[model samples]
Target: MKALAHLNKYLLKYKWYLVLGTVFTIISNLFGILPAQIVRQSLDLVKDTLDVYFAFQGSSLQSGIRDQFYTTIPYFGFLILLMAIMKGVFLFMVRQTIIVMSRHIEFDLKNEIYAKYQELPMRFFKQHNTGDLMARISEDVGKVRMYVGPALMYGINLVVLIVLVISYMLSVSPKLTFYVLLPLPFLSVAIYYVNSVIMKRSEQIQAQLSTLSTDAQETFSGIRVIKTFVQESFFADKFRAGADEFKKRSLKLVKVDSLFYPLVMVLVGLSNVLVIYVGGQEIINGRLTAGNIAEFIIYLNMMTWPVMAIGWTTSQVQRAAASQQRINEFLNEKTEIVSRKKLMTEVKGKLSFRDVRFVYPDSGIVGLDRFNLEVAAGESVAILGTTGSGKSTLANLIVRMYDPEGEIRVDDVPLKDYEVSYIRRQIGYVPQEVFLFSDTIENNVRFGAGELTMEEVEQAVKDADLYDNIQGFPEGFQTRLGERGITLSGGQKQRLSIARAIVRQPKILVLDDSLSAVDTHTENVILNNLSRIMKDKTSVIISHRVSSAKLADKIVVLDEGKIVESGTHESLMNKGGVYFELHEKQLKTEELS
Candidate 1:
């Protein structure tokens, strides 16, 4: 119930719908009570006539009373039928209104989640998985929708049912009502105690299910790697363990389900027995009339639903409450990396870093400690480094992936003050890992760049040295790239990535080790072609090969997360520093091969 308070944003939008739905619910419940009231009075009348037939004591005095009861039975029956029909009509209206609202809520929630994911800093996605995110949007949102719609409606109805039944019982006979309902408060207290446990258990279930989905998704995604290592048995054991854990939690839920209904039934049975035993004695002692006892029995029947409904609604409320906790966690996550004060529209590609420092979130190691560099616009430079030299970290900071605690600027404007979208638009980035979508080759090449003519696409392909290979395909540009372009070779995929970036045509293009797997001949051709293609654009190429870095206007070598030496290929060779050592080492390795 505490977690449900987070629904303020969604509920505020549809306040009128909620009010209208509850109005209809109360109306239906009010009308729903009429049939029980009418039936109770009609049965009481029949009991009066039976008492007269038996010629019980004071029968002569009760003749007119019995006559009046018989006369009014038919009218009560008519009233009962009228209320039943009205209940049906309004119940349908309430169902329609709430269902419509539920659909809108689900749609809005999904959109909000998607929009938030897009607005979140890239680091959020770097640490999460696609399938896990998909599960939240699809599966978790569906749970919230169902809870908001049917569960809420039924819950409101339960409250109304309890109130109406209790009032009718009190009017019938307050003493008998109290005697029969003495256990109800105790039951209410018991349900309240169990509600917390139910909430905790349901939350566990949802989390376990999400983890199971993530495991299955990751297994499928890395099936190739698993096969390469022949780790079928190991993964099978891992999956079995996860499945058993899920089964264990689910069985706990089943145990709760099995216990809850029977407890409600026991309380209801106690109330029924009290009504019959105590009400019958009151009738026998002449303190209560037989007709009154009959009405009391009818009212007792009316209380059954409110009892069961309270329990059912409790279960639903707990589930919904548990679900809100997970959703609120997502909504409240603060990246603290995004700009909130102002939006800067003009962001040029002049990249600069001044005494910058950063540590990865929740980690102690400095990704960029005292990093300092500057690249003027239209200067082609290459960053050479080993795996952990903060090469990619430098590029990520330029795009604001990791917010540096120290100063970094673009076009002389602080990166945080500049609009994120504006800065991203001016720079084209092709990551080390190429991930083409499961779409046509042309669409992947022109992704998010809008429509492109065949000539434009072909020219970009030509510039990336992939034009000839694509032309050889039977479908050519129309060829569908299978999942992540697995249908294409490694070099072809890298070239397609280059083509995609080329289509963006930004002022600064950062290729972060995007060509590490291509053949030597293809790499040479790509490097040669890139020189002419990005003649005026500032290009930041990250590579390990001397052949690739030789084309850059300047080469910057890094070791242990710090810059060691930086200069042109000829100047670096004359200096005989780390760059010269790397060039000679690579040449020796090539000669040995």
Candidate 2:
């Protein structure tokens, strides 16, 4: 029950509807008991009238008794019919008000979870799988709704019905009421035991389902690799194993759940039998009338549903608690990335890294050790580094993807002091690994820039040297792309990513080895176009080839997460250091090719 406390705000938001629903529930059940009493009284009235008729047979009183029976019987029957009709109407209102409100709350909860996902840091995602998160959003959320809806409704109904029905029974005969309630305590004990077992089984079932979802999602995403490696049988067996485990856990849950209804029904049956036996003896002793016995039995039957509902409602409560705990765990997570500072104006692209240090969270391996760099506004600086030389790590720092030990600044404002959104908005980043959405080329290029014009998109496409290739396609910009733009070649994908970045017209551009797939001729053409576009903006280029770095105003070389050289290309070539060796090797490799 404590697991559901977080939903209190939503519950309060729709308090009026729930209140109205509760009122209707009470009214419906109140009328629900009247029909049984009516039947009992009508039966007694008929039994006495028949006696009077027999006593007065062939006498003047016989006609009068028959007349009385004809008038009274129709009136009693109409009263019963009226109560039933009213009960049905109020019951409908109860369902409409409370049950419908739960659906509305479910909608709000789904949206809130999605917003939280957007707000969380990248590190949170790295620690959680996509499939498990998806299951949380879908399966776990539905389970929580069950707690709010049917479980709440039935639980409340049981309480109200029990109180009213028991009071009436006690009024008729206290001794009979006591005997009828003998089995209730036992029923409660059973419910408690079943609740614990169901909760544990529910957790296992949810976990297995998450594993299955993850397996299926991963297989679909890596279908190409699976086919290439001929590992279909391997994945199929893995899926079958997951399915079997899921089934076994579910069956265990079903076996436990299957006990609840029978246990409740058996207890109710015994109570009913005890009522008949005890009440008949009381009637023979002249302590109670037959009409009183009939009325007591009617009230006892009324209590049956509430008692049976105990077990089923307990199952719902336990299942909901387990799901709520899972959901609350995620909602309570502390987000590492948040924007609390306010920037007065749009940021300038003067970037600097001062003694910055960083380590990957999982491996505890240093990604950057006391790294330092400065790039003034409106300058192009190229970084040349080996595979593990921290080039991309530096680019990620500028975008505030991760926090490091020392200060990073833009326009003299510390990165943390400036608004995170403002900083990211001012930079256009093209990472080495490109990811394109499954959409038309035009929409992909203008994804984040919702208000971009066709002319602006065309200009960006031309600048990235992708316009000519796109023009050759039948649909041109409207051509739809496959997942991750699989329909395009490697070079085309890189250029499309570049076009996406340029369309934003950001203050700073970071191309982290974004052109590795292009040939030298095409790379030169794209670089020439970029030189013009980058004239009045700061640009950082990460590249391995000297040809790509030669056009920059200055070049910096990184080795093992530290700067080894920094100078103009010609000056570095003349110095015969690390940069000189890389340039010479690249020249020889090109000559041989």
Top-scoring candidate (TM-score): 2
lDDT of 2 at 302: 78
Error of 1 at 25 (Å): 1.6
Per-candidate total of colliding backbone pairs: 0, 0
Clashes of 2: 0
lDDT, candidate 1, 177-224, per-residue tens? 888778878887888887777778888887877787888888888888
* Model 1 steric clash pairs: none
TM-score of 2: 0.95
In model 1, which runs have C-alpha deviations exceeding 4 angstroms?
44-82, 125-135, 285-298, 340-348
Q: What is the lDDT of residue 97 in candidate 2?
A: 85
Q: List model 2 lDDT by residue over 1-593, tens digit each.
A: 89889889999999987899889989999999888788878888988899889998999989999998999999999998999999999989988988888898889999989988888877788888988999888898899888788888888788888888888888778999999999989988887878889999999999888899999999998999999999999999999999999999999999998897898788888988988899899989988777777887777777778777777788888888888788888899988666657664676688888999988786687878898888899888999998989888888888888888998888888888777776787889998999999999999999787698899999999999999999999999999999989989999999999999989988999999999999988999999999998988899999887888987889999988899999998899889999999988988998898
